[model samples]
Target chain A: MSQQKILSRPSVGAFMSKYGIVVIFVGLCIILSIMSPVFLSMRNITNVIRQVSIIGIVSMGVTFAIITTGIDLSSGSMIALISVVVATLSQNAMNPDQPVSIVMPIAIAVAISLLLGIILGAVNGTLTAFGKIPPFIATLGMMTVARGAAALYTRGRPVGDLKETFTFIGTGSIFGIPLPIWIYLAMGILAHILLSKTKFGRHVFAIGGNEQAARICGINVEKTLVKVYAFAGFLTAVSAILLTARTSAGNPTYGLSYELDAIASTVIGGTSLSGGVGSIPFCVIGALIIGVLNNGMDLMGVNAYWQQIAKGVIIVAAVLIDARKQKRG
Target chain B: MKKTVLVLVAMCMLILPTAIFANGQQEDGKILIGAAMSSFSDKGQTYLQDGVREFDAENDDVEVLMTDAKDDAAVQLNQIETLLVKGVDAIFIVPVDISALKPVFKKCKEDGVKVVIGNRMPAEELWGEFDVYTGSESIQAGILQAEWVAEAMQPEGGKVGIIMGPLGHEAARMRTEGNKQIFAKYDNIEIVMDAEGKWDRAKGMQIAENWIQSGANLDAVLCNNDEMAIGALLAAEGANLADDAIIIAGVDATPDALEYLGAGLDVTVFQNMNAQGYNGAIAAYKLAKGESVEKWDWIPFETVTPENMSEYK
Candidate 1:
């Protein structure tokens, strides 16, 4: 038995580290299915995916940030800021004869949304990389500033009466799939490619793995960090636009506490908060885990108070698993 | 690091100026009224503030200085102190939570600042502290919404689900209690499950979707606010539930939810927020004038349905 334990440790550790989170995800699904038969139904599955998509997309960017040993606290506030701003741009007149307020073409608004994301993200990145400020402090500051800006921009009122086509990005479905789900899948693939197939992705890993060694090996740490944060910010903008479209309004209070969810998804997906080692697929799985938990608990008639407790426990457990794995390695 | 710090400060400069509502100066011969708002970021609150601003814009003798707490209870406390220091004769307050009452009321009383509550209500016991309370009853909102939804279900009372705002929130708790009081009267209408939606649309949408997928012959979806009701409507549509199969009701006749009234949403309660704000300011003005003010300025919560939605719109 002792000899077998000795022989099996290396392979098992490597295998578990690679696929442990996926296993947890599947285990959770099976458990939820047992608790409620509808948990695995086609409709329920679709619902869960749709629900997780926003945070899932945000988590992809967060995964990149985490892999570079950084964080993004500004995602939530950025969502509110972007949504309210973009909603104004894509606004439809209450009636055709009435004067609309600064309505732009929907396409231009979307483009501006993406540009806004890149700029805000670049700010977070720049602060961390060149400003030498910790990502947490930098993004935290941005979070406050962005939320305040959203409120100031609209004076605390929601920007609604959106163009129908703009709302379709959130509400419309194509070929039996919701638009948000399609966006999630598309963003996931794009992020995976950017992280795994490019030199930029490697530099990110190197920075997170050992900044001193990465610098010695001639990786442009500052520039890469900036790009990484910009990517995260850009993704936040996409989410912001989608959410505004879905709800048919852009309230300044939107996306409150969502940063914690995105960060939790990244962490639970096996990304180390200490920085380094994360995956996009794992991030998606992590968000799904949360979605299922919410769906399942609500279905079972669990108290809302208990739902919060269970979520907290699960988040802690995921971090514990990651910590334990790192210790053994 | 210094450059980034400078940049961050520069970014803050853009927003920080909005927070400084008063320069602690009283204009010559003008009555200064400080309005401590719970949030300038909420539509309802904005409407409330607009009512006061309109009052401000019209009168040259009274200048209204407004501060946004951004929905922070602690910030609201500090804002009240700032208002007092600015030597405002009276303050219009929208408390973020009940946290402001005891301390803010005590401080205002000590400094002889007249306090008038508007929009949302504070805790029951603390109600005595404020000079006047002018707002619609949240309980009535729930009762009106619940009564309408219950009546809609008719002879065949059906299973229902409730989506609430943040737990322990005064509005969420009282509104829900109001709903329960009415729901108890119906024999056929049964509440299957209820969960907090955190006053969020996405959370509301997901909760509705999960209830639908659970295959509970859900007859109604009741929400604490219009955002959740609208979300539930979208979820119900997403699930292909027949339009007439479910009764969805929400409080607060917000525009987005009003748009869905006939199509998906069944009923919503209009709290007449602008009137509440305008009246609250008037009450404060009366106190400033040393005139006797009524303790309660109760505004009626009107129920808005498809038939009456046009009026609200």
Candidate 2:
């Protein structure tokens, strides 16, 4: 009898550890739907998902960083910088006689932005991993630097008048779904595979689980840290591209304080700030919860001030629950 | 010995600059005017600067020194202090926070420097403290926006949704209050919701999307700023709502907002930011010349529609 009881205890704990946040998300949906008749409609659901995708892609990258026992404050500023660069390039400034093909500009813009993100991420990683700066401080410095660069690049002016094809990526739908939503899902899948199936992913968890121990076990800590930040950079680039496309204009001030949302989603997704304990799928769920909360409150006509208070309470509750689960484990 | 030399070098670095700065201010025979700007990033502020520059170029006897506060009141205080030290004859300020600038304004008074306040009014009463206040009333902007919306709705009152700017901001508060006052006058008009968009395009769009999804009987969405107005328009378009299904109006006839107005959005109100700067410079010049300064210089807010769009543009 004691043996059976012990076996059941582990199973129960396992179930709770894996499904706690999911339960809360489901509960929120139920309550919100009960309160608002239109909350559960297909259109609303699609809207919520579409809305979450931008930050959702961001959280996926943040999940990787957090799982490696690091934080990134620069992602928001980096996204803003990328948005302007992409928008400026995508604008047919030349006003070609026949209207140049949209494909070339988009491809060029994506390549340049991705390169910029990777370089910035690499710089951040080098500072933290080699220069002995803490991840928080390193990313914070990069945050200011990146934002300044963005402002300087465009001289604080917003770039608009984007070509039709460029905007299509943001506004277009394939098979009745927004393109951003698809990119977000694809990015999520890629992140999951990286975290679950790749050696780099394994090294990341190892480093995050215990850096000293990871070093003892022949793991290249510096290299893994670099890869982790670079991966985050790639994700930030994807989000920036999508955001620029959606807005059809890029301003230096776009994506202000977005890192807070990305971090919030990661923590709410049941990821510990201490690292080594997050999944991309859970992070997406966390993003969805936030999106749903904001959307649901709007639908219910809740006051904006009250919505802010509720959001803060939910974030605190989520973190507390996560802390408790970790303690129990 | 080495430490002593280092200290002397540092002392000289500091003292020499101040000595030179004092000489520079006194040596010039021209009238010195300093304009502390709130921010230069936005189009409104840029236009305001254009007016300031034009005034400087036109007046050979007056030299205007400009500093951008970048939305920080502390920075504005420092800039004002710098201008005071430079012994400017007069000062023009488009303050970010009026209350935070109280001490600086007092100091300007003690120093006998003429002060012209523009765009944002000081927190305290300005009857004796300031020479002239040049800006439109925030509440007036809101009233103008509502009047346009009311005219569009005509005979029957309709449901209205409000997308406010940053909560607790003076402009946002006054505008919302103005909207409430005007909205209450019409028995047929009802305010269904007032949500904060924090003066952002994305947040405004998200709020409008939720309101639309709620299936509320909304006749119009009024925004505190043009950005939010554009956001609401985007959400409405995304939902495939007809153009006439909802009337949209915003304050500030920004370039983008003008485009939207031209493209068929209902209304926008022009605050004449350039005029405020232009008149503010002229006020400071007259005050520096020891002329009797007016107490208030009110810039009127005009409604912009498709028909009147060309004039504003």
Candidate 3:
């Protein structure tokens, strides 16, 4: 197949396979703009990006997990847990007569959340890689545990009255751009480089593609799997911090079933769930498509039920198109 | 295979009754009432449980056997059936979905067990099927929310946005309807956007942020519940909107909402959950004892504004 491709110009099918998803995303934007004038405005465009930023960050992590032939159902629950912890810490610092600098509490909150995310991710990784449990089951168990911990921590009450400095992390802008968008872009770039340029990245793809062959080739498959999941956990902590910031509070019920949205974003971005075939850029676009569909429908005043139906249809269509491309390839 | 079957049957014999009998402690002289909760995760459900516990503490002749349905209609139906098997004198249910529980309610009725529907009312067709329906009038909360919005917008009514909870939900529907009725009275107030927030704070914030960015020229946001109102507040504060730049009103008056109000949220409506639950349980007990009780009991909603914030706190 490679010899034939080197000898001839790329076929129409191949070209479409490479660029079809991008075309669909652009086409959706154009169509939405035509249907609703507000859709194309710069302000609205930024809003859409801002809206997609949370899911986009989390999806980048899930993208890694998908490429490694693993799933992380615990991201949503991890976010819930981390948000509660951070909210509690930040709220405590904001109390009157505290002598410490505001930075102390915020830093401590972020550090604790990151550490907890890593530990949780490591637990999933250990179960899946060493315990020989299926990725789905391992993460599903963690999902429940993490959620319970969050609810138990606050007893179902939402934490509020956060410090101004803590809220600023979510609401503050960097050079007229929202902080979340910058964080998402930075994360996306980092993930792209790690997946495409690093040896550990190649190890992940190899392990996902054929674990037996990867082990035979002297790759530390278990270690790579654990590291991949750890990366996903770290990303989820980042997302939780941003989300908690945006809402200006943390509630146990926050981020319910959000892992499903992240998975959907990854799948819709043309990531093959079977493994070893997805990109961060495409995942961002996929997240954007979802964000656009939601924002556009709201602007057009479509019924929420119809909006859900449309979202489901588009997700299926995206997968169907990807399957068609696979057949051609 | 015969030995395995014998062992399995023995295990079931030992396990089945113990599980069912956990809450089935019925005394000869006491009336046993079964309570099925739709969920215990949210504040409202917890508040309901607190009221029930309060009732149990005060009552001597009545025992309440409660079960959590975990927000699943099927689980709720199963719990009701379990309660029925235990042969409770009466059953009270806060259904996950009013429509989904009709058959179960019918089954209870056929068994001659009195049913009290709490929190949410079933459709009008099933109104006659249940002994009583008790809770706050959901529409009243909406009316209070919209009235506050109207008052805040004043004579120079401005464009408003409505952040609805899950569409088609009875509470959400009634609340939106109430808002519509009030807005209709004032020609000056225009609803520019009415988007579903899916009863989520993040979703509510996302919609509000988008509306703000779209330059929708919105002056107020009416949320069906406290969660969404808090979301809108975050969005407005993020956009650097002045404290009084926009009027925001929400229902439920949750603890978080009250905190938001204390921190400068415009308005909230208190639905009096304690009264609803305590009163509902007492009425159920009265009916169970063959005493006269109101068939349809309504708990009023109180408006909480910044001016009267001290009273609520």
What lDDT tens digits, residue by residue, belong to model 2 across residues B144-172? Answer: 89987987788988899999988888888
Interface RMSD to the true structure, each candidate: 1.3, 1.5, 2.0
Per-residue lDDT tens digits of candidate 3, residues B1-313? 9999999999999868645553434535577788887776666677777787788779988888898887788889889988887767677788898677777777777766778888886788878888888887788888988987898789799998888888878899999989999999999998878888877789999888877766677889999988998898888877788878888888887877887894647889987777766776787677767777778888788999777877776
Residue B166 C-alpha lDDT in model 2: 85
> Measured by TM-score, how close is model 2 to the native structure?
0.93
Model 3 error, position A321 (Å): 4.2
Q: What lDDT is reached at residue B280 by model 2?
A: 94
For residues B158-276, write the lDDT of model 1, one tens digit per residue: 88888999998888988898999999999888888899998888779889888888878799989999888988998898778888988899999987788788899999999888888
User: What DockQ class does candidate 1 belong to?
Assistant: medium
Q: Write the per-residue lDDT of candidate 3 for residues A263-282, one digit (tens) a residue.
A: 99998898889998888899
List candidate 1 segments past 4 Å from native.
A1-14, A94-104, A325-329, B1-27
- DockQ (Cα-based) for each candidate: 0.62, 0.60, 0.48
CA lDDT, candidate 1, residue A255: 92
lDDT of each: 0.86, 0.84, 0.83
- Ten residues in a row with the worst lDDT in model 3 chain B? B18-27
Better of 1 and 3 by lDDT: 1
